[model samples]
Target chain A: MTFDWQYIVDALPHYKTALWLTVKLATIGIILAIIVGMVCSIIQYFKVKVLSQIVQVYLEVARNTPLLIQLFFLYYGLPKIGITLSGELCGIIGLTFLGGSYMAEAFRAGMEAVTKSQIETGKAIGLSNLQLMRYVIIPQAFSYSVPGFGANCIFLLKETSVFSGIAILELTNTTKNLMGIFYKTNEALLMLVIGYLIILLPLTLFLTWLERRVRHAEFGN
Target chain B: MLNSGISVLFEGVNMQRLLLGLLVTLRVALIAVVISIVMGILIGIIRTSKNKLVQIPFRLYLELFRIIPILVWLFVIYYVIPANFDLNLSAEVVALIVFSLWGTAEMSDIVRGSIISLPKHQAESSKALGLSVAQMYRYVLIPQATKRSIPPMINLITRMIKTTALLTMIGVVEVIKVGQQIIEVNNLDHPTISFWIYGFVFLLYFVICFPLSRFSRRLERKWAT
Candidate 1:
């Protein structure tokens, strides 16, 4: 079969709109995930027994299952329970919860990597537990957490594509719609692949650069 | 309503359907894991090659796979590749190919990391003893890297399995799809089956993934000690 460059050229405008939507969802979802993840990680770290256990269970369920199910559960399952959110809202919420669970793990791992001696040193200087955490523990923990957190964010960005299943009109949804309209599955998909590469490559590079900068600063001479 | 939902989970046909779904889930995961391992080793080796031509292509391949989402890749293969290439492959075949490509990038990174993490002196000693490069890797370097890689690889396998749920979106008839179909059919009579069916699906995935998570931790501890 002959190749058609014009089809892809014509599809650029549609892909651009989808790309904007994908980036918006991913950014909003990631911001929400970071806030929720920080809260969950702090709850676990303090070890408030019952609440921590509840948080643990929630995280496990979210982490182990697929995001597709979680999205469907919210989109379709919730309407039965008298809770109706739009498909886009459901997609964002689903991604946030899933991303938050993984981010909590990242936060916990970072917090654990902070040496006890550092906290003790803070205490020796008469800093209270809250003061120490606010000033010493959290700062160091966040630095150590950056690499893993960045990786998780990249993963989350990629995962937002699944939102298309519920008809969220993101990048993947746009490609699917175009394919349906034009019946040029190949050209539409090819454009989608290129669109994703354009968006993701710079993000990945930035995260990698941030990771390297953090490592260097942490171990500076 | 809650009690009725609970009973449907235990009923015969629903149970049978869930079990079959679980089996297919495991099969897809197992096949993907095997494919990833083989591809990982090959790409990992190619990545470390001294040849600039070989290394550049392999590095580009890894980046492309890593940056793109698996779902997008799945869609490309399922809807785009066949039509583009004029090939008429089955959905399952497409899923496998897409997963393998994604897994290969991840596995290669793991392989490269573990191999480099080994003590430099070990390789130096092997070379000093006249071991060829291939022999050094085959007999000396690989065994240690494989052990280090296994735990993360197992974790990645669980990820691959959970991700198979995305195949349902493409009409793959996998476990999650089966649950969706059941919910659609039972919408009128068993309105609450949706929650229980998905809850059951969640539990099934947990049962499969939790052991791998535990095993990875245990291996990590053992290796550390």
Candidate 2:
């Protein structure tokens, strides 16, 4: 029952792949969420009829539901409809859809934070709505959202661990597999905790720094 | 809109089975929330304290809980504790511990935020009125903080309820786990049954969570104005 390093040493290589897969899942998932978020927020911002209502419903359903159920629905339920996806693929998609909803809220807040005065001035200067959005509104709105984007990315990283529930062999899954073989559940889990801590601790720190830097740059501090 | 799933709930499945699973989830979440609020308030008070030693441990706790996903926490609590310490705990008990631990950390943050956001003069006036520190907190501070805290607290409720779904991963036989079991037992290699059963699970969660979330949002908007 004592903590043993031997099991971890023996299992390190497999764990590395799991860690990499976790990273890849989170990276691709956040990227897709950002894309989804930007599009949805833009549509909602313009008060686009019908589409805005759809966006509202999508955001609410996603925000309310647990991500594990969403993953199960995609992983287990979707195949019922004649579509089969690998666990990793389904997990990444689930994370993308879940994180996309939160990311949309952030972007919407950022866009609304752009004062009416700024838009009016842009319009007053003979800028077309298209030119204004491209040159002024979107850039400023994005800068306002850098902090939100950072938070959303960190959240997406955490959410990717849910992939293990669907058997994606991520860090937690790798640990469980090692435990199955080595019968060193505690040691294996300690190593897994450390692995995630190592990855996430520095990430939280870096996001904090990045947020500060973004805020300073925005305020010209 | 989701009534279609309700028929699947009772059509080929034991209604009591799903309800029992759902009861387990609700029982765990309810107990965990009560524990969290109590522990959270105490920790929140310490978090605002002047002593560094008092604050550092809670700070570490918060940071650790923030990164470690609930699924990992559930696994570690359910499996790691028993294996390491030679203590046997049931699934529901372990789930309760993990959820309460995580919830306390989060709720404390909420408490700290609400209290800190109060005007400096409010606390000052309480002190100037000859109120002791306890009185200042109990009579003057908690009321205002509670009002400001309602929105975030509601958000945490929805989060706590949703997190109970992760209990399925650890084999808790909670609602989602029950849904999975039903799908497996009923379908017998027919995937389409899962479409209805899992769809019901989704709608069940949506029904429980949507109203709370909208209420939280409304509170947020109301307070913002």
Candidate whose TM-score is highest: 2
The prediction achieving the highest lDDT against the true structure is 2
Among these predictions, the greatest DockQ belongs to 2
**Candidate 1 lDDT by residue in tens digits, B44-68:** 8667667899878878888778887
Error of 1 at B148 (Å): 1.4
- Candidate 1, residue A81: the lDDT equals 68
Deviation from native of the Cα of residue A78 in model 2, angstroms? 1.2
**CA lDDT, every model vs. true structure:** 0.84, 0.85
The sequence of per-residue lDDT tens digits that candidate 1 reaches over residues A63-151 is 88889888877887777667889988998899899999999999999899888888888999999878998998788888899988998
TM-score: model 2 vs. ground truth:
0.95
Error of 1 at A126 (Å): 0.6
Off by over 4 Å in 1: A1-10, A219-221, B10-12
Worst 10 residues of 2 chain B by lDDT: B1-10
Runs with alpha carbons beyond 4 Å of true place in candidate 2:
A219-221, B1-8
Worst 10 residues of 1 chain A by lDDT: A212-221
